[model samples]
Target: MKKIFSFLFLQFFVFSIVFCQNQKIDGHPAWIMQGNIYEVNIRQFTEEGTLNAFAKHLDRIKKMGVQTIWFMPINPISVVDRKGSLGSYYAVANYNTVNPEYGTMEDFKNVVKKIHKLGMKVIIDWVPNHTGCDHPWLDSHPDFFVKDSTGKPASMFDWTDTKQLNYKNSEMQDSMIAAMKYWIKKTDIDGYRVDVAWNISGNFWKKCIPQLKKIKNVFMLAEGDSSYLPKSGFDAVYPWHMFHVMEKIAKGTLNAWAIDSIRKQTEKRYPANTIQMYFTSNHDENSWNKADYETFPGAVHAPFAVLTQTMAKTVPLIYGGQEEPVLRPLKFFDKDPMEWGKYKRAKFYQTLLELRKRNIALAPNASFKKISVGNDKAVYAFVREKAGKKILVILNFSATEQNITIKDKTLHGTANNIFMGSTETLSSKKWKMEPWGYAVYEY
Candidate 1:
C-alpha cells in the first residue's frame, strides 16, 4: 500500500507539471490578445492574382479594422509532378525568393512596404514540413528528404506533388531556419503562419522559432491544433476540435449543450495563456469542404462567428471574400477568383471587428462564464466580463425559434444591443431567439 501511494504521488506530480506547460507563455506579442486576422488567398483575392493586383485592396482591408493579414504561400511552386496547372501553394520550390508567377521580388517588397505604411502586420505562409519535388535540395542535399522503401525521397501520403523533408539532419534544420530568416530580412514580414507545423519535429521548432524571434519579435501561428505546438513556440494554434463539434451541432448530430461541455474539454487541453485561432471558415473549409453556405448557412454562421469572437484565449480569422459572402467552393490549384459582389456583409463583419477592438471584455484574457437559460438544449449563452464591463451573448443553435428567459443576475439591468441598436431592460424580460439567431448585449 505504501509503494502504491508513492507511485501515485509521482504520477500526480508529473501530470501537474505537464498540464502547466502552456500556462507560462512568454515572448508572444502583446498586440495579439485583441487581434483579428484576415487570411488572404492572394491567387483568388482578385482577377489579376498577382502581388501588385492584391496591393490595391490593402487600403480597404485596413479600413475593415483587421490588424493582421495572413497571405498564403507566395513562393514558387515546383512543376515536377505538380497537381494542376497552377499547382498547390504548399508545394514550395524556393525558400529565399518570391514566385515570379506572383511578380518580381521587388513587387513583393513594395507590397510589404505598403501594408506596413497602413499600420497592418503581414504574415506569409511558411511551408517547412515538405517541399516540392523539384526543389534544388533534392539533388544537392538528398539527405534533407525522407527516404522511401527504395531509399529515395518520398512524398507524404498521396501528396505526390511534394516530398516530405527529413528532420533527422541537423544541417537541414539550420538551412530551414536560415531560409525563414531570409524572408523577414528581405520583406520585413511581421511573422509566419507555419504550415503543417506539427508534422515536423517539436525540438526543431524549439530551436528555430526562438532564433526567428531574436531577429524580430513576431507572432507565430501553427496550423496544427496540438498543445505541443503552442509549447514549441507558436503564439496560437488551430481549434479544429471545436470547429468539428460546431459543424456537428449545425447538422443536429449534437445539441447546444455540447458547446458547454466541449468548451470545458478544450480549456482542459490547453494552458491558461494558450491562444487558439477560432474560425467558421478558412482556406481548407472554403475549398476542400463546403463554404459557410453549405455547413453554417444563413443565420448559422452568425452565432458561430460570435462564439469565435467572444471565446476565451482565441483570435478570430476571416478568410478573404468572406465579407462578400462567396457562395462557391474556391478551387485550390486553379484561378477561381472571388467575384467581389457588393460588400453586403462588410458592415456586419466590421461591427464585430470594431467591437473586438473597443471592448476589453471580449479580449482573449477576459473572464468567461456560461449562462443557462430556457431551452438549454438549443440555446448557448455566456457572459464575458473584464474590469467593470460585461458582454452577454445568447445564441440559438437550433433551426427553430427558442423562447428563453434569463434567471441569472448577469443579464439583469439595462443594456444596449450593439447590433440592433436597441435598449433593453433585461432583468425580467423573456426573449425569443429566431432560428439560428444570436444577440449580443453590452452594459
Candidate 2:
C-alpha cells in the first residue's frame, strides 16, 4: 500500500511540473511574449495628423519590424479649461469615440483593420483615472466625479482641464468597465495602454481587465510601475526606475552596474515573469522632459537602447520619432509634426527588432545570467539563454573605450555578430569596445 501511494504521489508531482512549465506566469497574450511596442503619437506622426494620413506609412512602419502599435489617446480633447491651442491627449472628453482632429471613428477603425492586416497588434491609450472637464458625465452623472472642498468636480493634480473619476462609486466603476468594453467589441482593437494606471484603483483593473479579455485575448499595459499593477492583471508596467537609471548612466552620474540593482529589485517586487516596458524615451519624456538626443545624447543612446531591447522580461518601446531621431522636445499641446529625414536610424532599429522576433534567447521568459566581463562601472555584460539558444550582449556606458575579457569558459565559442554580420571565435583574449559601444552575439 505504501509503495502504491508513493507512485501516485510522484505521478501527480510530475503532472504539476509539466502544467506549470507550459503555462505563462505573466498572463500576457502569446503575441506579446516576443514582441516589441511602438508608441504612435498620431497627432505628430504626420503633418496631416489624420488617421488616413498615418495609414499611408503603415507599410513603411510594418517593414521596420514593429509588432505592437500603441496609439496615444485618440478620444476628442476637452475644450473647457483647455491648456493651449490644442488640449492634452490625456484629457479625454469621450471614451467611445475617436478624436475629430485625427479623423472620424470609422477612420480609426479602418486604421486598426489595416494594422491587423499587416500582422501587427493595435492598442489605444485608455484614460480611466480622469476625464476632461467637459465630459458629459459631468452633467449626466455629476456624482461620478470627485468633489472638491467647494463641492465642485476637482481636477487631477494641477491639470485643471481634467476631473478625477470617483472610483469609490460602484456605478462609475461599472461604467468605466463598460466604456473599455465598447472599444474591444466595436473596434476590434487588441488591447489598451491604461494611462495613470497606478492612480486608478487596483480593484478596478482586476474587475476591468478580465472582462476585456473575455471579449478577446487582449494585452493590458499599465503606465504606472506599482507592483500591484501586475497583480491587478497588467501584462506589462512602465520601468520607471530602470529608465531613470539609464538617464543617470548617460549623464555620467551613475554606472552600468546600477542596472543590476534594478533587476534584483524588480524580481523581488513583482511576481515571476512580470514584463516591463523598457524605453529610452516616450511621449512624456519627449515633450515634458527632453528628447533622447538630449537625455541619452549621441553614441551613448545606442548601448542603452540595446539594453532595453535585450534585457530580461523587457517589452521594448520605441517612441514614434526616435527613428527619425527627433532631437528637440516635441510640443505637447500643439502641432509639432515629425520631420522624418531619410529614416536615418531605421536599419539600426530593424536589426534589433528583427533579432528579438527570431531569437528565443531574447524572449520575455528567457533566463538571464550576468557575465562578469570586468569594469562593472563602465560596462554591462549579460547572457540570455533558452531552449539551447544563447545571446550575449555587451554595452559600454562610458564615453571612453573599454578593454575587457570574458573570463567565463562556458561563453567561449564561435558566435555570429548579428549587427556587424560577422562570425568570430571568442575566447579569453581581451576585447577593446568603442566608446558607448554595443554588441550582440548568437552562440
Candidate 3:
C-alpha cells in the first residue's frame, strides 16, 4: 500500500511537469553533431595526476566511443590562499602555459598530437573569468583585475586564492583573447570549455570568441545555461535547468515527464544549433555532491544516462571514473585520484554512445516526440525518429512493477532491443518495467 501511494504521488508530479516543444539548430560543427563527450578531471583522473600518466588511457577511452575529450584546467594553480594542498583548477596562474604538475610544454603537445592521431578532438577547460592571485598580470598589470569597492583586487564569491579579471579593461580583453589564441596556435587543440561563462559580459565573449574561431573552427562550450551564451558564439551550454529537474526525478521528488517540461523550457530559450552538455556526473558534481552512484543508485542511473545521451539537442558527457562507476566523493583541490576498477560500466556507456554515433534519430538536431504509455504518471516514454530510423525509450520511474500498453501508432514497428540484443515487435503493445527498470529498443 505504501508503494502504491508513492507511485500515485509520482504520477501527479509527472502530469504537472510534462510538456513539449522543439527548437531548430545550426553551426554545430559537422563532426561533433553526433559525437559524445568525455570530461577528464586531470587532478583525479589518475593517481599520478600528470598528462604523461593520463595519456596511457587514450585507447581505452577511444574504444568507449568517446569522440571529444574536455580536459579540466591544466594551468598552474595559485599557492596564495589556496583552497587545498593542490588548489582548484580554476585558479589559473598563467593563461599561456601548461602546469608543471601535469607535464612540460613539449610533453603536453605530444599528448595532444596522440589524441588527434586517435581521431578524437580535445578541448581544454578555460578559466576566463579570473586568474590566480599569483598570476604575473597581478604584479605587472594592476588595471587588468577587477578591483573591489576599496580598490583592491577582487575575488569571485569566497575564492580568495584567485582574482577576477576585468573584462571592462580593453587592453585586458585583448590580452585574454591573445592568450587563448596562443593555445590554438601552439598545441592545435580543438577548442575550449569556458568556465563561469555567465559571469563574463557578453561583449567580451562577443569580441573574444570570434577571434579564437578565426584561428581554427573551434568547438566552444560555455559553463552556463544562459540563452545569450549560444547567441554569443558558443557551440554548447550546460543544461543546468534540465539537470536540476533530472536530479529531482532521480530522487523521486519529480516524475519522468518533468524532463519534457524542462526540455521545452530550454528549447524555447536557446537558438537553433545550440547543444546542451548532458551528464550524470562532472568534476563539481563529484567533488561537491554525492557521485552518481550515491545520488541515483542502481537502476535509477541507467535510464537517466540513456536520456542524457539520446535526448534532443544534447551532447552526452562522461566524467572520468564513471566507467569505473566511482563510488566516492573525489576531493576537489587535492590529489584524491579516481579508482579504475574493472571498468564496470564500460559496455553500458559504449552502447549508449555508439547508438548516438550510428543513429540519426539521436542527433542534437533530430526530432523528439514524447509518448505516453501508462496513465501519464507511471510511464515516461519517448521516440526519436530520423532518416527512416527510430529509437524508443520507456522507463518506469517508480520502484514497483508497471505494465502499460503503448497505444501510439508511431511506435508500432519491429525494434532491436538495445540492451537485450534481441528482436522485439512493438505490435503487441503491452510492456512491463520492473522496479526502476528501463526498456530501450532501436529500429
Candidate 4:
C-alpha cells in the first residue's frame, strides 16, 4: 500500500509541474529583470521615413539604456476607405509586406540587424483583432472574416476602416501565427505589442505564444490591461488605470492620496512577476491630447519622468519625440516631422535613465513602499528600497511651493538627490518641498 501511494504522489507532482510550466506568462522560458522600452513611430520619426533613416538613432537609443524598441505597424496600409491622406498604419492591407511609404523589406531587415547589433530587442505592433478591407485574405478566404447577421462582412466597433477577424476559424489563427513567426525568422525581431489584445480570445494567444516561443524567447506586451493575458502568455500590460489616475491628478480632480490609492490598487491586482508599462505619453496620447505637457498641467516634467522610473513593477516607455518636449499633435496621416531641438527636458531624461540603470533598487520588483501621504492634498511621498539601497521620493503635485514634514525616520538618511544633483540629509522631522518639484534621495 505504501509503495502504491508513493507512485501516485509522484505522478501528481509531475503533472502539477507540467501544468505550471504550460501556464507561464507570454510563454517566456525565462524571466526578465529591469527593462526599458522605447516606441518607434517609423512613419513620423524622420523626414525620409525609412528604416535606414531610423537606424541612425539606434546608437543614441542604446545609450539611453533602452532594452526594447516597439515599432508601430510596418505592414502596408489599405488604400480603400483610408482614414486620412497617408492612411492609418493600423489599416493593414498586407500583413507580410512592408509599407512602401516606410521602406523596403530589405531596409526593415537592416534596421532589425542594427537594433540587434546594439543588444536591444525589437517588437512590431500586431493588429490581430482587425484588418483593413484590402487584406488579401478577404478575397482568398472570405470565411476567415467575421460576418454580421445580415450576411455582410462585419465591422466590429466604430473601426469602419478595419474589418474584424474571426478567431473561431483555425485557419485565421494559423495565418496570424505564421505571420508573427515570419517576422521573428526573417528579422530576428524579439516579440510583439499586440494591439487591442483584449478584443481577441485568450485561447488564441495561448496557442500562438507557445508556437512563437519555439522560434525564440519573445516578450509579449499587450496594449490592453487584462491580468489573465499576463497569466496566460503576456509579459506585461499597459497601466491604463495609472495613466487615468495621473491625468486626474494633473487636472486637479484628484489629490495625491488618489495616486497612492491607485498604486495600492494596482499592486493588489497584478502578480508580482507581471510588469506594467508606464508612460507619460505615447503616440495616441500625444496625437489625440495636446501631449503630456499640455495634459499634465502644473506637473514638473522631470519629476514626472522620474516618478515612472522609480515606480514598482514598471517598464518605462519613451515615445519618439518625448525627449525633445515636442508639444504639437503629430500629424497621423501626414508628413509631420518632429522639429528636433535641444531641450532641458532631454537632459532631464538622460540623467533619469542613467540613474535608473545604475540603481538596482529601482529595478522591477524592488521595494515600492508608500511611506506617507501628507495631510496637504498636493503632496505624495514614497520610498523604494532593495537590499541595503533605498530611495525616498517626494513630489509636490500642486503648482505652488509647499512645506512638508517627514514623520518617517526610515527616510531620514544621507542620499543623492537626482533632480538637484546634490546630497540631501533627511531627518525624522519635517522638510519643505518646492511646488511642482520632486526630491529623489538615496541612502
Candidate 5:
C-alpha cells in the first residue's frame, strides 16, 4: 500500500507539471498584446502583383508603425472551376506551394525575410475548411471531402471553385494540420489568419491548435465571430457585430449608444483574454460590400477608426490601400491595382498607431470606462487606464458641431492633446468639436 501511494503521487506530480506548461502555450503571445496588424492584398497592392514588388514598400509600411503584416493566401489557385482571370485567393489549389504568379517559393521566402528584418512579424491567411477542386486530395483521397448525390466532392455554399473538407475523417484532419505545419516550418511565419474558422468543427481546433503551438508560439486569428473560436484556442476573432454597427451608425440608422450594446454582448459571449480584430475594411468588405470610403464615407470614417484603435481587447487592422484611401471596389479575381495617391491618411494612422505603441493605457488588457458626454446620441467618449496611465478618447459622430462637457471632476488635469501636439488643461468646461471631430488625450 505504501509503494502504491508513492507511485500515484509521482504520477500526479508529473500531470501537474504538464498542465501548467500547456496553460502558458495556450495563452496568446505577449508581443501581440499591444501591436497592430496590416493586411496585404498582394494582387491589388502593386502593379507587378508579386512578392518581390511588394518588398520594396516594406520601409514605407514599417514607418507607418505596422507591427505585423498579414499576407492574403500565398498558395496556388485552382484552375478547375476558377472564378475569373486570376481567380479567388481563397480557392487554394496547393497548400505547400507558393503561387507562381505571385513569385516562386524562393521569392516568398525572401519577402518574409525582408519583413522580419524590418522588425515586423508575418502571418499568412490559411484556408482549412475547404480546398480548390484542382487540389490533389480530390483525386488521390476522395474520402477527404464531402460527397454529393453523384458521389463526387461537392462545393461549399455556391463557392463552385472550392470543395468542402471532410472534418469527420480523422486522416483528413491530420493532413490539414500537417499542411498548416509545413508553412511555419518552411517560411518561419509568426502565425496564421484562419479563413472560415467557424465552419470547421470545435474538435479539430481542439486537436490542431495545441499541436501548432508546440512547434512555435504562433498567434492565431480567426475570420469568424463564433465564441467557440476563442474557447477552442484562437487568440483573436472577427468583430462582425461591431463592424455592422459602425456602418449603421455612419448611415444615421443607429446612434452612438448602439456601440455600448455590442460591447456588452461581446463581454458576455467570449472568454477572458480573447482579443477581437477591429477594422473599417477587409478583403471581403472591399470586394463585395465596397471599401470604407463607401461604408464610412468622408469625415465619418475617422471617428470609427479612432474607436477601433483605442478600444479594449482590440488589435486594429488597416487594409491595404486604405492609406491611399482607395475608394472603389477592388476586383476579386482580376488585376485592378490601386492608384496610389499621396498617402492622404498616412499621418492620421501613424499618430494612432504610435500612441498605441507608447501608451500603456491603450494596452489590450487595460481598464475601460465609458464616459457620458453631453450628447450620448451623437458623441462617444471613453477612458482607458492601465498601470497608472490614462487616455481619454472623444469623437463627434454627427454632421453638426457638438458642444460637450466632461463631467468627471477626477479627469480635470494637465493632458497632452495627442493629435494637435499641444498640452492643455482639462477642466469641467464645455468643449466645441466640429463635425466628425476626434480628440485623444494622454494624462
Candidate 6:
C-alpha cells in the first residue's frame, strides 16, 4: 500500500510540471517574453505585388534583428462595395483563399517556409469584426451578419463597404475559429495580428485561444487598446495613448515630463507581461498623417527611437520602407511602390537593433527607471538594468546642443556609447550633448 501511494504521488508531481510548461499567459509562451517584431506590408513592399518579391527582402529584414514578421492581410479582397481601385485588405471575400494578386496558396506556403528557414516567425493580419459586402458567406449564410432595426443586415462604424459579423451566433464563432486553425495547419504560420480586436466578443477569443494552443503556441497582437483583450487571450495591444503623447511631444505641444506621466498611466492600466507595440509610423499614420518625417522632424527622431527601445513593456516596430526613409506616403488601394535609395538612417536603425540584442538591460520587460529630467524641457535621461547588465540612455530633443550633468550615482563610470561607437566615462559632473544627439551607454 505504501509503495503504490509513493508511485501515484510522483506521477502527479511530474504531470503538474509538464502542464505548467505548456500553459501560456497573455498569448505568449514563457520563452517569448524577450523578442522584437517587425511589420510587413506585402502589397506595397515591392513592385511585383507577390510573395516571391517580398521573400527576397527577408535577408535584409533579418539583418535588422527582427525575430518576427507581421504581414498584412493576404486573403482575397471583396469586390462589392469596394473602395478605390483595389479594395481594402480588411474586406475579406473568402476566409481561406489567398489573394491572387499577392500570390497563389503555394506561393504563400513558400514564403512561410522561407521565413522559418531564416529562423524567423510570421504572423498574418486577421480581420474578424467585418467582411466585405460581396463575401460569399452573405449569400450562403446570411445569419452570420448582424441585423438592424429595419430588419436588414447592419453595417457598423460607417464602413459602408463592409458588413459586420454577428458574434452572438455560435456557428459564426466556430467558423472564425476554424478559419484561424486552417492558417495554422496549412501555412504553419506563427500567429495573428487581430484587427479591431475590441469590437469582437471576448467570449469568442476565450473559446478560440485554447483550440489554437492545441495546434501550436501562438502570439496574438490586438490592434485595440482595451485591457480585457489581453486578459482574454492577446499577448500585446496597441499603445494608442502613448503614440499620441509622442506626436504631441514632437509637435512641441508637450514636454519630456509628459513622457513620464504616460509611462506611469500605462503601468497602472495593463498587466506587466503585456507587450506594447511601439512605432512612430504605421500604415494608417503614413497615409493619413503624412508619414514620420512630417510627424517627427529633424533632431527628434533618434531620441524617440531610443526611448521606444529602452522603455519598459515596449517592442519596436519598423514598417516597410522606413529604412529607405520613404518621404512620401504610399497610396492605399493603389499600386504605389516604394522607391528604395541610399539612406544614412538605415545604419542608425541597424546599430540600435544590434544594441538591443546584446544588452540585457534593453531587452523586453527589463527594469525601466527614470534617472533625471533636466531643467530644460528638451533633455530626458533614464537608466535600465537587468541581471548584471546596465545601460544609460540620454537624449537631447532640442535643435541646439545641451550641456547636462549625470547627477545620478547609478550612471557613474566608463561606458560604451552605442550611437557614436566609442567609450564615454561619466564622473557624476557635467556632460555635453550635440544637437539632436542621443547616447546609449553600457555600464
Report the lDDT tens digits of candidate 6 across residue range 113-153: 99888878788999999998888889998999998898767
Query: Which structure is stronger by lDDT: 2 or 4?
Result: 2
lDDT of 1 by residue, 1-443 (tens): 99999999999999875554222334467667677899998889899989999888888888888889999999999999988789999999998888887898999999989987897888999999999989999999999999999999998889999999989999999999999999988888988999999798779989999998877767899999887887788889998888888999999999988887877887888767788898889999989879677888877888888888888778999988888889789999888988885877788788788888888888888899888877888999888998898899989999999998889975788998989989988875777878989888888
lDDT of 3 by residue, 1-443 (tens): 99999999999877643321011137656668888889998878888989988999999999999899999999888888788898989999988888999989898899999998998988999998999989999999999998999999999888888999998899998998889999999998988999999998888888988888776778899999998899998999999998888888778788877877888888889997789999889988887888587777877888788878888888999988889888888888878987785898999999988888898889888888988788556577888888888888887777778987878876777789888989977874576778777878898
In candidate 6, stretches whose alpha carbon ends up further than 4 angstroms from where it belongs are 1-27
Predictions in order: lDDT:
0.87, 0.91, 0.86, 0.80, 0.91, 0.82
Model 5, stretches more than 4 Å misplaced? 1-26
lDDT-wise, the better of 2 and 3 is 2
lDDT by residue (1-443, candidate 5, tens digit) is 99999999999999875564344322787668778999999999999999999998999999999999999999999999899998999999999999998999999989999998898889999999889979999889999999988988988778999999899999999999999999889998989999999999788999999999998778899999999999999999999999999999898899989999999999999997889999999999999997697988989899999999999989999998999889889999999998775899999999999999989889778999999877999999999999899999999888889998989987998999999999999998887999989999999
Model 1 stretches with alpha carbons more than 4 Å out: 1-27
Q: What residue pairs are clashing in model 5?
A: none
**Number of clashes found in candidate 3:** 4
> Considering only N, C-alpha and C atoms within 3 Å, which residue pairs clash in candidate 2?
none
TM-score per model over all chains: 0.92, 0.94, 0.92, 0.90, 0.94, 0.92
Model 5, residue 13: displacement in angstroms? 31
lDDT of 6 at 334: 75
lDDT score, candidate 5, position 171: 98
Candidate 4 vs candidate 6, TM-score winner: 6
* Residue 255 lDDT in candidate 4: 82
lDDT of 2 by residue, 134-244 (tens): 999999999999999999999877989899999999999999999999999899898899999999888888898888887777889999999999999999999999999
lDDT winner between 1 and 2, please give it.
2
TM-score pick, better of 3 and 5? 5
User: lDDT (0-100) at residue 197 of candidate 1?
Assistant: 91
CA shift at 331, candidate 3, in angstroms? Answer: 0.5
Clash pairs detected, candidate 1: none
